[model samples]
Target chain A: DAGITQSPRHKVTETGTPVTLRCHQTENHRYMYWYRQDPGHGLRLIHYSYGVKDTDKGEVSDGYSVSRSKTEDFLLTLESATSSQTSVYFCAISDSYGTRGYNEQFFGPGTRLTVL
Target chain B: SQQGEEDPQALSIQEGENATMNCSYKTSINNLQWYRQNSGRGLVHLILIRSNEREKHSGRLRVTLDTSKKSSSLLITASRAADTASYFCAQPGTGTGNQFYFGTGTSLTVIP
Candidate 1:
């Protein structure tokens, strides 16, 4: 199994507070992604990094931002938390040599955030 | 806004029974993959089927993809209580990047 870990497994905060979730990987993979899961909705992409310092937004990147200064760490930040932002967040890393496809993603244990 | 949708939002089955989950995508994909998730945890990659391939298997898990119909199905045979988890289908976006669009997921319950 790939070595991936997510920090701050659970958190609860005020509506306007700022929250940061961290994803760390030991696999030295080139691709890293952040996603959120909610009831009745698929896992939606928030942000992703293809290389160090290279990141892009996804379908639901409205209130979130990400930064990757190193190959092993990807950080996700919510500038101002809202009730709608409360969901289980996941971090994933993909390698090109996995199998049939050029890239296959492996996920880290998620972080559960609740904005009260 | 979702690229893929899974059928049968939830399923409950007895141990030793078969559980089949289906997923459908809206766009052209390079490959489709399946994942499993325990409650409030990260997803685990189960299998991947390429656009040109029709079927693949790993142990008791069988996956079938119909690119013409833009659909795929995951079958877990002889289910056990340990097989209880949420299943999701992911379609890799068309490009060099590694972004994956996921389905809503089907929650499975295996009653022992």
Candidate 2:
């Protein structure tokens, strides 16, 4: 939990609703990522941000969106929640900017979202 | 298809024994990293081994990378009950290389 925090530790929402999860970090790392963990699927990257306002889709980016307006905060949003989206979400930050090599990533506790 | 996958989907061992997990990837990688997650918690970074380096050690953990085989292994010595957790291996994604693809993970249960 290297200075990383995810708001709304747990939430239960019905399908078709919009939900947002926030990830705040004190380290101001250059990289931020959103991931979802489900049994048998391990962790799948939902989205990632390299710098403020710069974001990219991941392996499971469909049906989800992300925003990074500031250096220390990254947000993941589900426009229309689906029961299939129910899973534990995690936020991670890394100091390394380049791909050649990366410092270890620090993760937040996580937010568990359940959609019915 | 470039995602890293861990072998031995589940492991059960007694305390004080050594536990080993292996990871195999489909493509080239600059490095490989191991992370552990306690039940209901976020992942915690364990160790990282660069492709150029054959092996690396940190505390009770030893990580070995085999670039030729596109695989990596994590060995934990003197396993403890506290070591019961899920272990995942991650590597840079194929396209941009900025994002990482993590494996499903190996569930380790260390019996005391």
Candidate 3:
């Protein structure tokens, strides 16, 4: 929450347009994640990166793509923005330990995207 | 699909009272975590209890995990108005996957 930040806190775009949301963390955590939140539904993971150039798709990765070219940055891109893609996006980072998957994730303030 | 579902979607209590919220998950998990989120804000990790551990506490926050039942509960003592927020429980689902599945969450209102 304190170390992670998402850029363009609010964005309004038209359908079929491309949009990119950026997640930056100063903590240098090893694991970065992208999620979307909607009404009646909690946060859902879209994509996650364990390290630079190592990314994987989450349960809901249909219209989203993620790239982590650097340690401090993870980007989520909407190839063709649609109204269904309009939701709040969150970036999270987790400090890795010897025991994998045991670390807690820290979240960003979130980016609110509107597709018109 | 959401791995957890929280009970009493919303709660209202007066100051200095105790508040409790329950979360039920679908599958076995290594651990369960509770988080709090204020309006228009990010989630703050509250507490995490492993499957082997039944209960844990952090100041006024107490968390209990019942692995046999695949459920967990978060308790807040001496609640204040500032505690009014949404609380969610998340657990890494049954898989090698790293993603943590979250519940719908419970909205807590501490009326002063």
Candidate 4:
């Protein structure tokens, strides 16, 4: 219940078209992450932003990009949507990485995207 | 690059029974955490256990960690229909930052 919300709860786009998913949080968390979930692959990290205007690639960053212009918003974009890119995208937030010990991650409701 | 894989990818149990899920990691770590996801909703934090601890309890939840085996288990006592969801375990990744690697997850279906 970290006050996280993802836009376009459901979407369908044609292949080769551009698509973007937005994640917004009310909490001023320091870290934000984007992940995609597939049938057998589980949840794979796509991109994450530690702070405003600072982002980095994740395990499955290919064909995907992210931008964070503020503390509350994290955006994931598919330059050219592909059938393989269809999956459920989830956004997460954390106060810290449990660097010193342990921390919890809050997740958004999630967005389901489909490509044809 | 550490990763966690859960056993018995899917489980089914009757209400009031006990449900146990196991998570195995590739590399040793100091801490591990579990999360639960209800179908289409997001994931909710469940519990956490550190390396030095053998067992920890949170209400109906019990978490046990074995560093020697690099594995952890979660037990839910007196399961209920509401407990039907997917469970995942996570551990810190290779880098020093806040990256974490999560397991493939175990889907539990509590029969009413």
Comparing 1 and 3 on TM-score, the stronger one: 1
Question: For model 2, what is the error of residue A48's alpha carbon versus the real structure, in angstroms, after optimal superposition?
Answer: 0.6
Share of native interface contacts recovered by each model: 0.77, 0.63, 0.65, 0.56
TM-score of chain B of 2: 0.95
Best candidate, DockQ? 1
Residue A39 in model 3: lDDT? 76
Q: Model 2, B1-112: lDDT tens per residue?
A: 4567888999999999999999998778888889999998899988888878999999999999999999899999999999999999998765442677888899999999
Model 3 clashing residue pairs (backbone): none
Model 1 regions more than 4 Å off: A97-100
**Which regions of candidate 4 are displaced past 4 Å?**
A97-100, B94-97
Question: C-alpha displacement of B101 in model 2, angstroms?
Answer: 1.2
Task: After the best TM-score superposition of candidate 3, give how far the Cα of residue B109 lies from its true spot, in angstroms.
Answer: 0.9
**Superposition TM-score, candidate 4 onto the true structure:** 0.95
Which portion of correct inter-chain contacts appears in model 2?
0.63
**Reference-based lDDT, each prediction:** 0.91, 0.90, 0.89, 0.89
User: Least lDDT summed over 10 consecutive residues: which range in candidate 2 chain B?
Assistant: B92-101
Local accuracy of candidate 4 as per-residue lDDT tens digits, A37-115: 9876678888888899989888999999999999999999999999999999999998774556666788999999999
Off by over 4 Å in 3: A99-101, B93-97
- DockQ each candidate and list the results: 0.72, 0.68, 0.67, 0.64
